[model samples]
Target: MSGHSKWATIKHKKGAADAKRGQMFTKIIKEMTIAARMGGGDVEANPRLRTAVLKARAANMPKDNIERAIKKGTGELEGVNYVEMSYEGYAPGGVAILINCLTDNKNRTAADVRSMLSKSGGNLGETGSVSYLFQRKGLVTYDAEKYTEDQILERALEAGAEDVATSGDSIEVTTTPDDFESVLTGLEAAGLEHDSAEIAMIPDTYITLDNDGTRKVLRLVEHLEEHDDVQEVYTNLDIPDDYDPDAE
Candidate 1:
């Protein structure tokens, strides 16, 4: 269930996204609204809503704003009706792409995505074209400085996680999507804290790219990520360890 994207890619995206708090909030709010609408407004009863609310709190979103989003989702308050959508494509260097979106206008979103992909030297693929390259799984990340690999593995296995791996100063735990929240909560309740948790599309394998190929693929990913309707983008890029995207 571990994601195949490079550590450099993750670092680069996180750094950029953190600088755009408003955009980040918009994405989170959309997820919350959709989750509540699909599973009801009660967080305790809706695992998707529980995860969305947890992310909102982690981002320091206002309590009132969270409540209002839930109300809107429950139809107690008026709000935009967003339909969940996904697109599969291949970037430069054959990097598989999975884009999750929440959109009120599918035609516009599709057109924009297709245009961006074509401009970036990629193609918007038909259904199942690129999706077969990835699997849906849940991921939980922890601070490695606070726990040894052995310790994380021990705790994670006991909590029903399928696998654990070390990525620099962080430890990642992978679990079945259905057991993700329970495993995460169990670990937290047992004194193991996680930095972030999410259900994601993880690639079974990765493809290494040269500097030029990497740059092109990264640019395409950045463009797709910036789309207002895009919720998340998954890829199978494995960047070299020494490369610094921040330096660019």
Candidate 2:
């Protein structure tokens, strides 16, 4: 498992996502709309839409809001047309970064991302520059304290999961994109709860950084994630278990 996955688990445990519920809703809604537009409105028939709906449900988004977003995407209601864009970049310590965005204006998004990178000791890379370091996979994480590794491994492997690993307090289950939903359902049936689940860009390797360098890279990721258009940010940074993100 990537340290980034553990960092996300830490954030979830800290209620960072809950603290920004409105912002989180906004991002999920955008994802749902785009997924519906690209695929179809039927969640059962559309894998992307189904994933988006699962994310919205995880956030406790209102059912009505989810329906409305899907309607907009299916053209049943008016909605902003968003273009999907991906930006490759490098964070501090030369850690590769991949940013996925949904934006109405490409020019504005590109400029904003470039400026953020330049100001944060990073620089945007040409297409495919840093993207090659990542592989798209479905990642499902659980609290290690709540579930034993053996329990998760048994259920995950039985459900077609590719790999299962424990990092710090997180138990991460990796699956192919096609098997993601089925694995989640199987886990649920087995009464295994998940902390966070998503189709993420997993790095082939990680760059372990010292405390100070880790903070610098984390700060840069935080800044990028704060942007309205930036949906997901992936990095090869290996966050140390003892590094306190809130420390000064």
Candidate 3:
């Protein structure tokens, strides 16, 4: 779980460059649109949309862009219809991975994903091939700089959180997907701030890798994340502290 948190922090830092790429904004917009379309346009009633909006705001996406995306999703404006897709596979060291995507062209997206997997010593698998290794949960992180471990645990647990752990500078809060919104609201009401709150696939266990293996796994992940159709990549590969994927 700590490894996952560290990876997320790394991703957030990399989001600066990603935000400059229009494709990143497009992906976030697609997520917002779909979340609104699935539920209602009201963020208050739609937790997924709320989360998407939060992420967009964190990315510094413009207010007008956010509003327009919401309107398009609600059919008040034109928008591309995107379908959700997931590809499961194994990377180096037998690390299981699941790539989530939203794409207008399923055939192209699948082909591109499969090709990337094959190029990186992996093979795409049928649905459910790797999903069994994970459990859907709401994973929220609070910065320890702003809140103590005790404070985080107290507020989160009081709001029906399942577990809370302090790892380095972060306090990880885990809950059932259904309890995500309420738990977030609880933290907000208590004046507790969070670094990230989202629905995630928490793997049952992890496979640690050495320098070479971690490099190979990260290369595979970076390739997948660079794909325009890919929304997020979930994996059980744990990179060691000595191995820094971000180091120049």
**Top candidate, metric lDDT:** 2
Query: Where does the lowest 10-residue lDDT sum fall in candidate 1?
Result: 3-12
lDDT of 2: 0.85
Greater-lDDT candidate between 1 and 3 = 1
lDDT of 1 at 68: 91
Clash pairs, candidate 3, are none
Which residue pairs come into collision in candidate 2?
Answer: none
> What TM-score would you give candidate 1 relative to the actual structure?
0.91
- Give the TM-scores of the predictions, in the order they appear: 0.91, 0.93, 0.87
Q: In terms of TM-score, how similar is model 2 to the real structure?
A: 0.93
Worst 10 residues of 3 by lDDT: 10-19
- Clash counts for the predictions, in order: 0, 0, 0
lDDT of 3 by residue, 53-167 (tens): 9778867789999999998889989889989999998988889999999999999999999999898888888889999999898878887788887888888878998888765
**C-alpha lDDT of candidate 3 relative to the true structure:** 0.81
* Alpha carbon deviation, residue 221, candidate 2 (Å): 0.8
Question: For residues 1-248, what per-residue lDDT tens digits would candidate 2 score against the true structure?
Answer: 22334544434433332326788899999999999999989999999999999999988899999999999999999999999999998987798889899999999999999998888888999999989888899989898899887999999989999888877788889899999999999999999889888898888877888877777877777787888998988888877667776776
Model 2 stretches astray by more than 4 angstroms: 1-19, 246-248
C-alpha lDDT score of every prediction, in listed order: 0.82, 0.85, 0.81
